[model samples]
Target: MNETYDKRIMKQKTHRLLEAIAALIISAIIALIFSFLVSVLSSSQVYAQRVAGREGLYRDSVYRRVIGQGSTSLSCYLSYPQGGSSVLRGYGHNAYELGKLGEFIRAALSDTLIYVRSVRVCGYCSVDGNYTSNEQLARKRSLGFMQFILSEYPFLRRYGIRADWVGEDWDQLRSLVASSTLNERDEILQIIDRVDIFSGREKLLMDLNGGAPYRMMEQLFFPLLRRVELTVEYDLHRIIEERYRRKLNDREFALLLEQEREKVRREERLLAEQRALKEKWQADSLAVEETARAQQARAQQAGAQESARRADEAAAAAYRRRREAAREASAARTEHRKLYPLWGVKTNLYALAGLTPQGERTTFMPNLEIEYFAFGRWSLSASALYAYWDFAQGEFWGVTSYTLEPRFWFSPTGLCRGLYTGLYARTGDFDIRRSVVEGVPTDNRTGTYYEAGASLGYVLPLSRHWYLEAGVSGGYRRVADKVYDVEQDKHYLVRNQSQSRLRLTDIRLNIGYRLGKKTIK
Candidate 1:
């Protein structure tokens, strides 16, 4: 019987080992299949992302050409004295400095790619002439500057040089009035704002505060406006193409060429629109002139005076319509300004509940925090947490803690979205019960403690103004408690009595409201 039992036990052991070997082999096969599937999925996802990224780059290239990155421009200030000639050499007050104008023109002409896009010459006089004479003087000054440019750079004659002049530099005058310490500053500004006509503005300024404001503007501001502004547009395409010719492949070059063609089309379309507007304006002016002639002829003829009156009314109506149309067309061509938020401040109130590792107490922490964002990505916050705990043994207590944290966000455009990590320091007071010793009851201990820790958190936007956040923090804490020796009936101080162990200080879920302007990237 003993021999038979030994044989059976040996057989059973062999069967069990075979079964174990089979199971391990099957597990290996399953793992290989899973790994292969994961690799295939990962490769597909990477390929999809690459295609999407390429498409986005293509779109952005077109947008950059259509809207234009920005125009590159050069500007120089030309100052003139009162009643001075606008000729470059005739700038008598700064003749020695004006000699540099030749060098400036030489440098601009030296660059083959630099094109003189436009020239604007503005002239000013002391608030001395009637609007008509002031307008003529301004035009003459502009012509003087234009003649100088033409004489020096005759090659620029092919390019259209536009001359614009304002009889009075009202904008500059108002700026001077605003900055001046004169007693009539407010009255002058009121006049500048209230008067729509140039003559009315000048008259009002002359009437205020014994015309002291007008004198201030004439001495300080008018000279600053007697100048010319030359806008030089340069072609960077040649430089960019040369730099990237060897780097970009055929496909990229083709796309770049397409973008350039689109930009040319856009510019042509804008020019056509401007030409149409100009033609319409001219036609409207001619029609108004003809109507005036017909009205005058009818008024001279007998019994046609009433018809002339009707023609006069119709001319006024046509003039009003033409002005309105011009205003609308001008508004359509104006560019919209882009805005961005530089800094922001926000306040958050959160209710957090969690338990200590011992599970002896359940904590309810209410937190109030204020955060300041700087340079978009970095934020610093100061928070106060008041924690109330309920023990299973019918004991209750509260602790107050203050935390200072500095966080950095991964998103560049705004706060309150994406992942963040931060370092924190917390200091607070806590009360807890010490273990019972011998037959004595548990000792109630109270003292202050401090913790230093790090945290990882994520923020998700719930709406335009609200966000949800969750995080975990862990650190070592040093506790100093006062212990009572019941046998001696006295209390003693225990300093640094708690061992340093990794403990979870807080598990927070927060709902926050964002204040100030919110930006999205």
Candidate 2:
């Protein structure tokens, strides 16, 4: 009786152990499936949509507050940072130095908040017709300031900073006259309104002190502003986000922060370099101007005496013109040289319509190509081709192929006026379409073709470093195909050949563009 009781107890223990193991396996499977469902649901959430909707509302409110109908006109001084210039201020270091102030204004604008979409920075001087009054000089100063910012901080490119020259604001003279006492008016001093204007954002940076009620109306408020200022209309929330908000970390948050900090430091260093270079340039320019003035004065004194040497003077003038032209051309070529080679892909949509000796066929061929230039005048390319066609309305067929052609070219001193030419060899597959003459399926022959060719082309550059290309070429080709027996046995194979070798005449006309780099190797 005791032995039988022990056996029953062992059986119950074994069954319990098996049941526990099964339960664990089921729990693990359930956990995995639940996790997958949670992930899928979370991924489909419209978090970005919600954030964008909130941002839109925030923008509208900011705009109304910044520039409203009831807002009174206030005068503000436009203080441009000293030493700024434009990109086109005669080729030299001073070019950027003259436009630095414009750079500062460009950097500070926020498209999302301030709505400062466009800015025109103008530089003017006090002199009526003196050196300072030269429109080009002031213009250069404005442009110099613009270029400095653009070169140092590429972000300013997004703000669209432009520069111009309006030597003096004569319209404001009447206002200045009205506000000045009779004796003070005799001082011949100029009064300018300094209002940096931005669209859509009403940001009040300055306030006019007590003055004539019509004082703001008569003379322009910000004409003589030496510095750069922005006129803006903005939303309050956007301003807050732009000025104070922080972005949430998705992952490796520390890495992102480090990257941002590095970028900031790099920009700061570039700005400092720009400032130092500009200061030196400004000093140099001032000295050059002083020397030029002295020379002009001396020339005037010698004007009468030099008349007998007219030929020499004429020669000197011609030499100066030639020198100027050469300088401009050299500058253009330097600008055209890109740091990297041109890289782009091409897709050809090909259609062929012709009556062959056998029948009429319409074909569509697709060509895909990828090309890259290794460096100065050297390039490599690869391409794939595919075609599908039907002939005689039910008689004949189609093919797919890939071809890779690599070649090298060189520009020989004066070949085609500084252009280049190259010779290339190509090999690829050619396929025949399916056809049925009797109630039997016909064989589709696959063949290989080899061709060699040469091409001549010229790169014609347009305004702003854009290029137009044209070329021509010719080559020879050979093809062969294989035939199989009806029984489809490996040992039963035959080759059929017709028009296997031929001299080919190929002519090509191409129009394309290059971007990112001028030289494609």
Candidate 3:
């Protein structure tokens, strides 16, 4: 019977070993398949990137420029009222010219085989002030022009539109000086060429010939400088590479171009409707402004009459006020005899059930606070709190802390009943144990830490003396502790002591009682 039992036990052990070997073999096969898939995906990604790079190169090389320097470029000039973005009504013809330019851009964008890359709007300002002010003025003019364009043709926003400022254009000034019939043309040229800074140039011109050159430039070249210049960059679209173009027939390419043109026409119609709406809105806005101005004038006249009436009434009230003031002085003297306490003490119940570093564990804390109201709507406070924690399962033992806080309350009249904020300083000692394997205590040591933080909270009165409060505090804690390392299922002391910076976060809730005056209101 003993031999039979031994044979059965040996058979069971052999079967268990075979099952373990089978699982290992299956795991190896799955790992090899996963590695193969990763390598294939990496290769494909590299190849796709290379192909995209090549395609970009081909597009740049084969595409032709359509609407830049040598080709057709359009220009429209609009004048603005002095120091304003509104178009000058006397130069209303410029608006019509701008409308024509918009039509041309719309037509170009409608073309299926053309790609509009960008539109550049360069703004220039007159030499009316220092370089900084002029630069800002130029940018405003440029932005004003761009706004007008987008308002007129809302569809053009899709194209890259850039606004640039050339504050007091020196190049344009130089050109004007060269071509003008002024007597001081040579002197102006010499001044422009000699000075590199804008302020120096302005000063030189003002000093030259008793400021004659400056006045002439302001009248002639300055007006021209306060303008916006527009430039559009576009290119012909290339759908396929040069080598692949032979594969597509002419009819297919034409169909593609025709489809693109249809889309452009639809967008243009939508933009035209938007432009009409914008014009109607502007007309209504002008009418509203005119009405407001008339009403404002009438209000001013009424205000003057009302002021005179108030002056007459105020004279009569002054005589009566003197008689009333004497009576109130006697009453106030009797009320001033009552005395109120200016100090208060409170304690928080919620600090006892606070959370600890180990999520499931909680610490018991007791806190006390004292406050003094020194002036109107201002008070100062000081508080102290103590905490203790122990968690055998989490390897923590005998952790304790003490904190001191100083606070300032903004509403002294509503002390312990309104809003309060404060700062705190904390120091603590802890003894904890950790394991190489989870749930197994392998190392134990004690440490000390210190932290400082700020807190904000609101106090709501439950009764005349009791209050409920909630707040959050955060700061940095520096810890001095022993370090342990776990390897080969064994624990080793790496360092007897080490320092680490830790971030501390705490949420607080309080149920406290106040001793002193009740809420004022």
lDDT of 3 by residue, 1-521 (tens): 43563464356346534643553464356446546644643552121111111112121211223311213445455765666765443575775867767676654454323445677778887666888888887788788878877787676687778888888788877898899999999988988888876438778888999998788788878777767777766532343322234445667655644654454454455445556555554554455455545555555777776555554455445434434443444333322222232665555545445454334444444455666765555556665554333444554444445666666666644343467777878786655564324655567555578888777777776644446777766777677875544344344555667555545445656654445542211
Q: Worst 10-residue stretch by lDDT in candidate 2?
A: 46-55
Residue range 389-421, candidate 2, lDDT tens digits: 456534333433444554454553211112556
Scored by lDDT, model 2 comes in at 0.43
For model 2, what is the alpha-carbon lDDT of residue 466?
A: 29
Query: What digit string (tens of lDDT, one per residue) describes model 1 on residues 1-521?
Result: 44563464356446545643554464366446546644643552121111111112222332243225323323234554554445656454445544565565544444222323444444454455677777777778767767877787776666566666777666766787688787877887887788875547767777777887677777877666555555444333432344244455567766775665565566557657867886887788788878877776777785676887887887887788688768866753532111132332222223344344344434454446666666467788787655544444534444557789888888665543679888989898655543445644355555568888888888776544446777777787777755433334333333335545678876666665455452311
Clashing pairs in 1: none
Put the candidates in TM-score order, highest first. 2, 3, 1
Q: What is the lDDT of residue 144 in candidate 3?
A: 81
lDDT of each: 0.57, 0.43, 0.57
Instruction: Tell me the lDDT of candidate 1.
Output: 0.57
Residue 161 in model 1: shift from native, Å? 67
TM-score of 2: 0.37
Q: What is the lDDT of residue 220 in candidate 2?
A: 41
What TM-score does candidate 1 reach? 0.31
TM-score of candidate 3 on Cα atoms, chains taken together: 0.31
